[model samples]
Target: MLLSRLTGVSVLGLALLLGACSSTPEKEKVAEQPAAELYKESQIRMEDGNYRSAIAHLEALLSRYPFGPHADQAQLDLISAYYASADNPAALASIDRFIRLNPTHKDIDYALYMRGLVNEDEDRNYFQELFRIDRSDRDPHNIREAFGDYERLLREYPGSKYAPDAALRMTALKNRLARYEVQVAEYYYARDAFVASLGRGKYVLEYMPDTPEVERALELMALCYEELGMEKAQQDTLRVLKLNYPDNEMVLTVGS
Candidate 1:
């Protein structure tokens, strides 16, 4: 009986030892380097086009030292890294968060510029691009979104370093929008929807007068007026088209 009790005690002790070992939690692998070191490593990775690794390092550094001196810059770098990695949705979210969190940040202009670029990149059409199709008939929703982003950036930071490039992009966007309007006018005219075509053409002439598509819009308006028996309006539109595009084939044909 004594021997059996001793054996039972030994088995219980072994079980307790195994239980204690199992219950002991493993230590987390601590980061040995400082946040600054991690940030530098991320920068190097980004410069070398290792954006994924750069993002990982930046994320780790931010988590470890959320309030460090490099936190804000790290956040900015993270956005750039995400963009470079083509993680556009994450980049956009990060940019918006940064803007909201640091409204008066010195680099807000850059953030806005980057936001515009990201939105614009998302607006590209694959088939249209591959086929070299005219953009006039393409969906303008994303284009409009990008245009709004750039417009807000310009309005908020007129003197920003990125203002000039944003201005150029805005001009291109306007021309595209104007062309889309002209295309719609042409489509309506093709379908004998004279009033609708005239309205769309007039909208372009009034709001997008400076665009190259203005000539086409005017031509469309003239054609619609001619078809609708508005002789006076048709003559007036033809004169305006002749004044702007004196050698235009449509003007020569329609004017005669």
Candidate 2:
């Protein structure tokens, strides 16, 4: 009986040792791999749309080979992986770090383009579209940031391959920002807050003058002026609206 108890104790000790050995975690084991192999694996994962795995591999590669020949590309790939996984903060951080570290790199323009693209796509997601929340009332902060990013890209790299697309995106973002102002104006008008509506309308006109929302902004300003008993301002806005948008639907409403 004494020998059997001793044997049981020995088996238990062996079992515990094995359990501890096996519990080291799969990721730690992977960390032992070479950076080149890890980076190549990350590229494959990214191509397969396995962004989480790609991010993991790229992070491992960067940790292992901070100054490797593939370091810059790895950092750029990590940014794209983060963006693909909807990890905007991580993507932004990665892009910023790359730009800071390699300001004069040949691919710096691509980094700037990705920065703008990241901001541009940040507010465009499946859930937002599904709920229709973005179309009606969007936070203009992201749009404005994206616009600024694109502007910087164009200013710094005027002949960049991405300049054309960046320009197009800026135009769309401008309209969206103008539309946000229009939405705010409409909300104020609905609440009988004519002064606030006028302020928002004037902002849209001053900042986003050539946008389609300008007509609505002008109409809102005129209505607010009429509501506030400012007949001179109302007449002046109506004249400008009539001059710019001869067939404006709001012309009839403001005319009366």
TM-score of each: 0.81, 0.82
- Tens digit of lDDT per residue, candidate 2, span 138-187? 67787888899899989999999989998998999999999999999999
Q: List the residue pairs that clash in candidate 1.
A: none
* Residue 34's lDDT in candidate 2: 80
Give the worst 10-residue stretch by lDDT in candidate 1. 1-10
Model 2 misplacement above 4 A: 1-31, 131-134, 253-256
Q: lDDT scores for all predictions?
A: 0.83, 0.83
RMSD of 2: 14.0
Measured with C-alpha atoms, the lDDT of residue 8 in candidate 1 is: 31
